[model samples]
Target: MGDWYSAEYPSSSLHSLQGYRVFISIAMILGDGLYNFVKVLGRTIFGLYNQIRDKNSRSVLPVGGRTSSPTDSLSYDDQRRTQLFLKDQIPIWVATVGYITIAIISTATLPHVFPPLKWYYIVVIYIFAPILAFCNAYGCGLTDFSLASTYGTLAIFDFKTGYMTLASPRSMFVSQIIGTTMGCVISPCVFWLFYKAFHDLGVPGSQYSAPYALVFRNMAILGVEGLSSLPKNCLTLCYVFFVGAVVINGIRDIVGKKWARFIPLPMAMAIPFYIGAYFTIDMCIGSLILFIWEKIDKAKADAFGPAVASGLICGDGIWTLPSSILALAGVNPPICLKFLSRKTNARVDAFLAS
Candidate 1:
């Protein structure tokens, strides 16, 4: 099933996701994506039709030139004007359009650098990444739990915004640009050093397995080819999920939010498919810690819960840098403890006794 797009790459070079669950997730993504595409297409066609119809029906105005508001943008429920040093802040619409422009350019040009990631695939990611990022950001704001990719999982704090705690978007944008500039220079140097040390990727028993690269590569392969290129029944599952997404949304609309409150979000529903069994345990433990803290002292938890959570997340990430250095030095933890399944534990015990 590997590399159905071309015969040049053997099975070893282009690894296909043959595992049942992983294959299903691929199907789900494909199916849901197709549904979204259809919806967008329909809406675009309808909008164009309305514009043509409106132009044909509307009467010509006199020289007096009296009309309604020129702008038809949706009004926000909470409209609060923000200022930076007595000047009005840049509008959200301006930022959004600017983002789209930059993203389009990046999508169009990125394939020149990474051939596996075709322009169309990049386009699709650009279209949906914002929605996914919004879901992750909103969920993090509510629960302090980030779901999805590493970037998605980041619960960035703004001192001004407070929980988010909110920062000025313009300032955030400027800071991000600076950070990205640094990362652009730093990341390649770090990777080159790792490459020099490791020699090659996908080395068996190598400390740096680079699973993220493998996952993205598989995605790119599927995107370049098609769902049919994947393992058998995956395409069928993709079809099922696509229809299922539409039907589920229809049901939610009919039932209404009060009744549909129990229904998990599309993003939340994907967690089981994407996450491992052990991740659920970690989530539960984290939830329990916060719950207990809140119960013990409501005031302190309200004030310090976010700070503590932020510290824990930052600490874990910062620890990795030192850990990687230690690992490269061939230093292992003195006591390496692990939890194993009952069957695996029994086998290890039996072997040790033998």
Candidate 2:
């Protein structure tokens, strides 16, 4: 990866890891997908084998109840839990027809709506998407991870969280729609408030850069230009690293998981490229706190860890609005605390004492 980047774009001055990041990220995603694919395929074959071997083994709802999710492999015996999760499902035909109608409308309107995406592309994506989506959901059920935006990789929404909290897709959808509608109405005002609070708007090197705009613009460019526009050797390196990642995943699987546990997950390691070290440092701090809490009281930590995490995530976000208000109001702290070298500290202490 380093060699390819240095050779192809040697003089390109950008982010510290910009040269290697994209190639490494793609490789990790491709490799992880391949690993999950093989595992799923093996399980499917085994399931088929069991079905053929014995008529009694044919899939049937247990006497107590059926599982809520198709991916709930281990929940078949948890009859009471399954029964509770089972809602009066929206009619299958209604779901099927509604989805088909929406898909058809979307496909028919694509040329007018989004000129870059031909109707055929949508068809192709949707055709393959179902298979991948199901696999992704199943993989997510097994592992609490969601690579939602990543195609050809394992991904899912939080099915466990949804079931635990909402218990109904209908309820979730209604709530989601309501929240989205409200956000659509309110977000512009919030954006304007921040605009007023922060002097530099849309300036390069500003911390408040509109990253989503850049992301969407880049995606649009990629869609319009397609693979032909990729950097000279980038496409070639993508192929190389993708294969390497798959090979590494296969090797890990072949080796006992106990020993292979030492190996870092490709998907996880790739995260630093997008999010950088700030969040990683914050996570480490949170983890240290959790570790201490766990030592202090394992039961409480086990029970409240998720709740505490959710609270912290939400609570951290909300302070921004109040800070923005303060900024807009021209409020300033009376005294500022500053860290300094020994000489600077002594001078400051002496000045304060005087």
Candidate 3:
């Protein structure tokens, strides 16, 4: 067993190690470092803007109340806190710059491991990064990160149409990934703001499902493989579905909110197809429960329904963290009930026999 493990597993283990390192470098180090840098920068700029605006407004204020004294208008503690926060960000800036420099040097030297930095790739990244970032930020601000998959799909479509013929698959993949990553990194400001707002209202950050990373991963796989790998029929169906979705959305916009209940949301219609029946059924059941509750006692439901729903959603999300940690540690807690196992196995055996 030891000999077999040593000989056969080494190559697989090495590959896994390499993949893990790459993932850590790209997703955790680069992505998170960039996010922190941008977040601090945004916070500093906004803080300065608010301070200046307040000072300017105070200068014109009529002598009265708290505004009578400039020092009283802004507390010393608050000023100290702001200064401390800004001072703390100095290291983050240094770290971000160092990480970027190292990443550039590594990419230049080891293109096979890191993303390539070709001239065309640079141009593509420059052109699409801001556009994707804006759309992603806007979408996340308005809704949740559920729209990330849609944004990613749109980005891929744009890239394929614009640069597929001009660049190699690897180049296109790297550029698109970088563009999308930039969008995700910069858009965290909106997400963080919403997260804090929800947190203040008793919702945990985990309750806010940001499944865009998973969507980005899936799309990246598809991008690498190319459309030619897909079946002709599947491609045709996708085109037809795209047209239908566009038409449905157009009608929804034209009709507006007056007939919103009557019109189906394109996302709502499409999500079931992608995620499948179990999640779709769960969502429908939840919605039905809410609808019935609202119908029964409008005022009571309006008052308490949100709190109850938030608790349930947040509970599930909170539990998922520990569950995930346990899973990573190879301690998967059994979810199945012992009482149901016999009946389930019997049914399965009977079906198989049939």
Q: What is candidate 2's lDDT per residue for 157-275, written digit by digit as tens?
A: 45555554436655555666787788788989888877877877655556566643444455456566785554456566667777776777777777878968776555555444444
Over 192-289, each residue of candidate 1 has an lDDT whose tens digit, in order, gives 87777666556533567665555557667766787556655555665676567657655765799898866644434444455555555655677689
For candidate 1, report its TM-score. Answer: 0.60
Pairs of residues at least 3 apart in sequence or in different chains that clash in candidate 3: none
Of 1 and 3, the candidate ranking higher by TM-score? 1
The lDDT per prediction is 0.59, 0.61, 0.49
TM-score of each candidate? 0.60, 0.66, 0.42
Number of the top candidate by TM-score?
2
Ranking by lDDT: 2, 1, 3
Q: Give the clash count for each candidate.
A: 5, 0, 0
Which candidate model has the greater lDDT, 1 or 3?
A: 1
Show where candidate 2 strays beyond 4 Å: 1-20, 41-45, 57-83, 86-96, 131-157, 163-166, 192-199, 222-233, 251-261, 289-300, 326-354
Cα displacement (angstroms), candidate 1, residue 181, comes to: 1.6
Which 10-residue span in candidate 2 carries the lowest summed lDDT?
A: 10-19
Q: What is the C-alpha lDDT profile of model 3 across 1-354, one tens digit per residue?
A: 233123333221312222222222222222222343455578899989989888856555366554343445555644453444343232557646865675566545654555544644545554555544554443332222233444322334232212213343445456767988898986696556555554432222243444444435544665677745332244454445555655665576578899957876544544444444554676677778889998999877765665565566558558955865564455745674333357678998899999
The alpha-carbon RMSD values of the candidates against the true structure, listed in the order shown, are 9.2, 7.6, 18.2
Question: What is candidate 3's TM-score against the reference?
Answer: 0.42
